[model samples]
Target: MPEYIHGGDVYSHAERYGSLPLDLSANINPFGIPERVRQAMHAAVEDCTRYPDPFCRAARQAIGRAEGVPPDWLYCGNGAADVLDRLAAVLHPQNALLTAPTFAEYERTLAGASITFHTLREEEDFALTERLLADLTPEREAVYLCNPNNPTGRTIAPALLDEIVRRCAQNGTWLIVDECFGDFLTDSAQHTLRAQLGTNPRLILLRAYTKMYAVPGVRFGWCMTSNTALIEALYRAGQPWNVSVIAQACAAAAAEETDFARQTALRIAAERQRLRQELSVRGMAVCAGEANFLLFRAQDTALDRKLAAHGVLIRSCANYRGLGAGWYRTAVKTGADSERLLQAIDEIREDG
Candidate 1:
């Protein structure tokens, strides 16, 4: 069997441990899919027999309008993972640089292309600095950056990201920023590099609908780049009907639901703050995560084992590249779920 990377491996573990618990491993929206989105999916059910639009024309247009980028500049995929794989196939860089303890998929995709990859250590709470960029090899072909990065939930400052983009462009290196969790940030537009897409031909911005709309099953995501040529290349490499008919309609509807998006942002902000305060009171060393999750270092491995035993699963980051034992990540769920998780952690602390 393949090595299990993160949480949600409950099925394999469930065989040994019995029924799976509430999965907090994946950084998904705790609110789940909205009622409007579910209704849209039911309405789209009749279109299943017809093949989904190869271009995802309506969906792409909606996303383009919402994001202020032209439809031609966007390339939709099964998920951001699909876009990353296609990117690897087309770019096939000989060397890539990524932050250690960031998203695992970037490394996994790079490995599949037989590329040499290096990681920048996350000393100082996984923060990125100008000095880190200075260490990149002149021969390096590309760099993968995850904003409000996974596991650690640390975001690169806007000024720093601008400097990195400028430096990468000057060095003739491709800079792919995976902002899948960017939506979780309060001022997403301020930190996002989307507006600078046309300024730097070497930049590729990846965005996803999974976490924001709570529709991972739909597998909708897109890559934004000013390089029309690169966008065309990715489009050609993508499989036809990569996104299902229902998914396309659902994605289109979700993109247009501005009110829903606003409400989600507010709810997440409040819940995240509440979770942070509660965890702090419990004495867990929590990181000030900007995303919809809080990353904390448990006092010991006993906390992780105890939480799982209570049927409340959270990500244990021991498997990540640079993280060690005691690292755990949990999503900001509904108020009730949050309370349940807090209760579970309290129990663990009491027992320990």
Candidate 2:
């Protein structure tokens, strides 16, 4: 079994490195938590003594209103990770299809249940293409996809996604689409299939406030599907008060920040382009993804360690399947933070 490693381990790294490093490993909003969300969480502290609404009614309602989906079609979880686990448990898929170099949690969760899964190769830019259709056979119970996928940060083309969904429906396969980073796209609406949730029974849209709202610790995530029975089943599979009061309050306010997503996309799009060019100029193989992050490769597989010496942290793609040594991922943060990372990379290049 391959080891499971994830980003955002600043605490442990800081302890060992003796300095608080700028973490570009986790792709989160550079602006940090919105002001309104901060105030909401502070107010929620007083109510922490009471149990949170297990159904997370208020937060779901806010999300539904914003997304134009019915509240009942939504199910909240401790985080997107929690929701993914619940979906695996409730569906109990005997076999599933996943794209290689994608999120590891899916394989990890399904593996625990002894479920079988197959991976599709992401060659030539790592984009999902028509080749996936041939792999979606009747034997597969489900298909998992990460829009603006982690590590690579590339999104599946909308037209291709439509074809995939239609094919999944034909195969009686559940299409689980994780849009956790969709908000980072400048043209997210065109890419998001949430509007089709009212009609597509096989489509499951997984989303979270963690990245967009900069509240990963709050652990807020929700899923939407037209299949009422499946939604109820997933909710039932979770523990009571799965979303705490603090999370609910913060998520609700964050959801209500109608302009936050737009501003974030605009900011990230510019930075991502600039970062990719700069990295390329430094002789790195930069994958210019549309999300708020970039995946690149240098001749140095030990770049992560070298960057840490400069009080910087980046995601090493060594553990991610389909990627090998010399690959790295970094979030497109604020200009200053990005400059720091670029400076560190420049230093590493000069040292070489």
For candidate 1, what is the total of clashing residue pairs?
Answer: 0
What's the distance in Å from true for residue 246, model 2? Answer: 0.4
- Please list the residue runs of candidate 1 whose C-alpha ends up more than 4 Å from where it truly belongs after superposition: 10-20, 112-123
Candidate 1 lDDT by residue in tens digits, 42-93: 9999999899899889988999999999898888898899999999888988
Which run of 10 residues does model 1 get worst, by summed lDDT? 113-122
Off by over 4 Å in 2: 1-4, 112-123
Cand. 2 Cα-lDDT: 0.87
lDDT agreement with native, every candidate: 0.83, 0.87
All models, RMSD in angstroms: 2.1, 1.9
lDDT of 2 by residue, 1-352 (tens): 5543988888877799787789998888979888999999999999999999988999989999999999999999999999999998999888888888888988877864434434434356777778788888888888999998888888888999999888888889889999999999999988999977877898999999999888888899989998999988987896888899999999899889979889989988998888889888988888759998898889998999999889999999988877889989999988888899989988888998
Candidate 2's TM-score reads 0.96
Alpha carbon lDDT at 227, candidate 2: 94
